[model samples]
Target: LLGVGVAQLADYTQEDLFAQALREEAAEQEQALEETEAEEEPEAVVVRRWLPGQDVRHAEFGPGWVQGSGVGRVTVRFETPWSEPGRVRTFAVDDPALEPARPLPLRRGEGMDGEGE
Candidate 1:
């Protein structure tokens, strides 16, 4: 129906009715565009939670913990959503051996570790 109104408006070169219909159409389209833009927009703010036992390092303290802290330099906090904020530490991302460990166990049992029991 709206398209029909626009087509009719185009047919007449310069009539008051055609001009009015065009103006109405332009306004309707503008309103629809605004609604679409508003709906597509995301929230203004987002929050991320920290967790415990996860591997992490800071810019100064080296590698430490999922543990809590009390110092003023940094306050460690839990990374997961389930746990409370633990603590923050000022650590270096570059500790000599801060990289992830291998999937295998750190060491074998007495019999397994040695050549023979």
Candidate 2:
């Protein structure tokens, strides 16, 4: 009987306290969700433009670019970013060596660099 009385008189015995705590927690969560929803998220914008002196590797003639291209041909000025202009080689746009390539610092962590996968 003593134990039952003590439990009955315990501060935690009030059911309203637990209910209020739950209500407060739920309110906090709802407020957080509302705040997150209210915040604006930026939209993604894509821009594509050809750049000069970019790195390009060809399958036939090897790495080249930085020069320019003309009618029916792409004249790649053979030279790496670290060296002077080597020689200008003309090749068809569909040439095996002339292939589009991703700039340095390629899509990291994708594990899809040169595998062509």
Candidate 3:
């Protein structure tokens, strides 16, 4: 009788372990499915209409002038008092840090220096 009881307990233990494994596998599969769905979701796209000579401000670079634009990029000529030639940097049109700015008065030798143009 004692042997039979032990055998029953062992069978129950094996069954419990199997059920737990199935639960873990199902949880993994569900998480994988959620990840796949997230990947399939379309991302929001922002369309920018930047033109040549457009005034823009950069969060870190200060005032800039839009030189040109391509599919997803914009070339900007930024004003840098530290450098006589100034600096030109390219950035994505959809950059959150770039925004329209009031036009700045052009200095005497601003864009005509031919050094940084």
Whose lDDT is greatest here? 3
lDDT of 2 by residue, 15-92 (tens): 778989999999999999987876755654432222366567767555565466555566677654455657877666
Backbone clashes counted, model 2: 2
Cα displacement (angstroms), candidate 1, residue 110, comes to 71
Task: Sort by lDDT, best first.
Answer: 3, 2, 1
Backbone clash count for every predicted candidate, in the order shown:
21, 2, 0
Winner by TM-score: 3
Per-candidate TM-scores read 0.25, 0.39, 0.48
Q: lDDT of each prediction vs. the true structure? A: 0.44, 0.61, 0.80
Task: Tell me the lDDT of candidate 2.
Answer: 0.61
lDDT of 3 by residue, 1-117 (tens): 554557658988999999999999999999999999989999756598899988888888877789899989999998743446668999998998998876654554555433232
